[model samples]
Target: MTFSKPYATREALEQTIAHHAWLNEHAGSLRLPAIRTVRADGIDFASIEGRHARFTDAPAVATVLGRAHAAAWKGDLHRALLTTAHPLAHGHELPDFVSPRIAALRRHRAAGLVNAHQMTAAQSLLAASPATPVAFYKDTNLRNVLITADGPVMVDLGDLTLAPFGYDLAKLLVTLAMTYGPLPPATFTTSLACYNQPLLGAGLPPVTIGRFLGHAELHHLLTLPYLGKSGYRHPWPTVRPRPEDLT
Candidate 1:
């Protein structure tokens, strides 16, 4: 996937190019496609070939996530990933994207699209998870991950950032809920149990895991409006949670 650097100066684009390169710099289960080139003369380009992700598919994404999380903890790649990702233009920001979900919520709130309770719920979520950074692909929905023959690879690391582990997990869960339906109770529970295995093994407090999941769920709600602003394209819809839904 290719994107034009929103900024005119080379400063932002230069940093983003580094983020692209860092994905390939690592040697591990979570490695992504090598960036062929990033053209900054006019429009930016970070291209790669042989994506061929059909083989890895959905389950492969989970395998990569489980492994990445575990490997991040075990080999201490977590710090390495964070160190490499920190120089990125957008790495340090909260919500991880240029258009952050919380900022989106504030806009909707001003327009009276959503009530304060939703904001309160979202705030509570943010308070729960630690603000620690990690090597995370901010966009992990099914479409972004490519199931390649070499291994399950993640594409579109453009949004890679140093953010809460739960944020990445929550974004994936939110995408699944939007694409499928309400979070599958049994499946969601099981998946978190699995995702948190590494975090727990790494010595994080047990309650922190629940906080990350809750924080991420609220992040989904916050992102809905921004998704709508983008024309509610496929996998995006112009909607927000009802009051009862928040409770």
Candidate 2:
């Protein structure tokens, strides 16, 4: 993405370029794209080298999340990030993203924009889940992941941070649903189980589709104001799987 006026300052552009360089130094081990940064005539541009396909399907999403999570949990890489204490590491900030005020949700609900039942369920899920923070790639949305012949590669490495165990996966799952509607109930269950195996292996907490969907719903509600009423459409169908069906 080009870093230009009305979007980012010159200092911000330079910082991004430096961060890309730092990430590239560990590209081989981390499976990240090599970014080539350029500046010309007062405009700065950053381009990822090599041809890669965007991961679009549910199975692809599961596979990539498993691999990325495994990599992030590796002893040496995990230690390196923690030791550096990078400013990008958003400590205890994931809750803020999913936990919007009741008054705000009420406003949306009153406008017929958010479902009252869904909002209550989401709040319950967040309350039940553990609040302890863990190191995570806070921005694992599909746009940042690409598929090459070898495997998936993550770009936009700047958002590495600390959040609850499942926040990253939840973010991607929600983004997937937003882009291409919700997955079938069986499909969602299978995918969650697939990714959870690695987390279990790493001694990290397994993600529940129920809790993540709760997060997804709240996130969707939060974005509506920014997206504007005219530009928004609900991603899930009316015939959704019952709450009991989610794990």
Candidate 3:
């Protein structure tokens, strides 16, 4: 099968295997399925056996996102709170190919088609947030999540980072919004309520709830190029002049 961009590297595959094993050992409470590491050319490949859910409808996507948000909130408040704090290091920045794309965004911003302030705000939140939960999965897009007879199983670990609790939620929400337009306010509100209730039940502070919403919005804006016509259908042209070249 043809895989998406940012295909798993040997080192990344090893790290994922190690992480899965560590989680199994330390957090036996999580009922995750077994995963084996495949080494080829001294590189590791991910191997998991499970079905994946196809998110064709908004409600279905919302359900998965909501459940993930709630679970993240319940499982780790500190990390959730920090979702607005810690930013990934430059070397670990998203999509593993962001320099050029960010440059494109800069040009778009200069044209007043995109908002610079909003993008900056999102970056600031990510930088300020505390390190994410150890078990936090960053990329929660449809391509990464798989549905099995039992439940959803995430496979891609490329975007996994130690930055914030709801980083994954924000990522998923942003993708959903770009693909389907704005989410229903009521649905988001309900999801937030459900997310906060468990934390309240556990006597944790619910401060990050607002930050999560803000980040979700910002993520949508920053990732706009990857969705809609700019994405899969119309890729950025190769050999395009630099932003300075246009001047």
Candidate 4:
């Protein structure tokens, strides 16, 4: 593969290359398409052999999400969360959110997409909380998950890492919430219930589900600009949610 244009910096380029290598080496085990080549601008994905399929041509607002929920209607989402044990179980510490991310939250507040009440409460809670690592899908969302008859396969390999369990849950749920706006509290119960307590197992503590949901809410605002088409239309904070309101 060849990049039509280079990545923003050397570090970005190197990271992309590394992720590509990881994905290439592990795609079959990951149940994903092998990459014969990848560059900053293009990729050559090995075709699926049999009756492969996509989620839908015109996924309704919740189609990808609903499908994810239905697919995981069984147990063990952590299995779904990672491609394999290949990455050496990354991100043991909760890395600090960078400055640009903070700025995006500020922008959300400024644009009335997030209010001070939610912001303050979430920030305070996050600041006080210690890091707890679990499976993390950094870009966990409808867009990143692929459906095959074989089962669910995580497509975007780069974002897979070990992070707070709440974080992985938050990103997928919040990623949906961001696109469709605030779903009723019952939405999580019905659609996201597969990842609930029984599945998390007793070895881990109760995840700060709301706190991490808030983090996911804040985390993706900065990411919108980079996501073409994906960034369109989801006017956030129009109703001014409390931090715990993300159900």
lDDT of each: 0.51, 0.52, 0.45, 0.44
Between candidates 1 and 2, name the one with more favorable TM-score.
Answer: 1
Q: What TM-score fits each model?
A: 0.64, 0.60, 0.56, 0.54
Candidate 2 TM-score, true structure as reference: 0.60
lDDT of the structure predicted as candidate 1: 0.51
Question: In model 1, which regions exceed 4 Å deviation?
Answer: 1-12, 25-27, 41-59, 70-101, 128-137, 200-209, 226-247
Question: Cα RMSD to native, each candidate?
Answer: 6.2, 6.1, 9.8, 8.0
lDDT of 3 at 34: 55
lDDT per residue as tens, model 1, 1-247: 7534354566555555665554444426676555445566434444434443231143445556765655544444444333232342345321242235557778878987667887787765544222353535547764565554565566654455554565565566556555544543444455556666655766653324455456555656666565533322423232223324333
Per-residue error for 219 in candidate 4, Å, reads: 4.5
Candidates 2 and 4 compared by TM-score, better number: 2
* Clashes per model (N, Cα, C within 3 A): 2, 0, 13, 0
**What's the CA RMSD of model 2 in angstroms?**
6.1
Candidate 4 global CA lDDT score: 0.44
lDDT of 2 at 237: 41
* Per-residue C-alpha lDDT of model 4 across residues 133-239, encoded as one tens digit per residue: 33333455666555556655555544444333445445555555556566565454443343444334434444444554565555555444433357324544442
The best-first sequence of candidates by TM-score reads 1, 2, 3, 4
CA shift of 9, model 4, Å: 5.4
Error of 1 at 12 (Å): 4.6
Error at 135, model 3, angstroms: 7.3
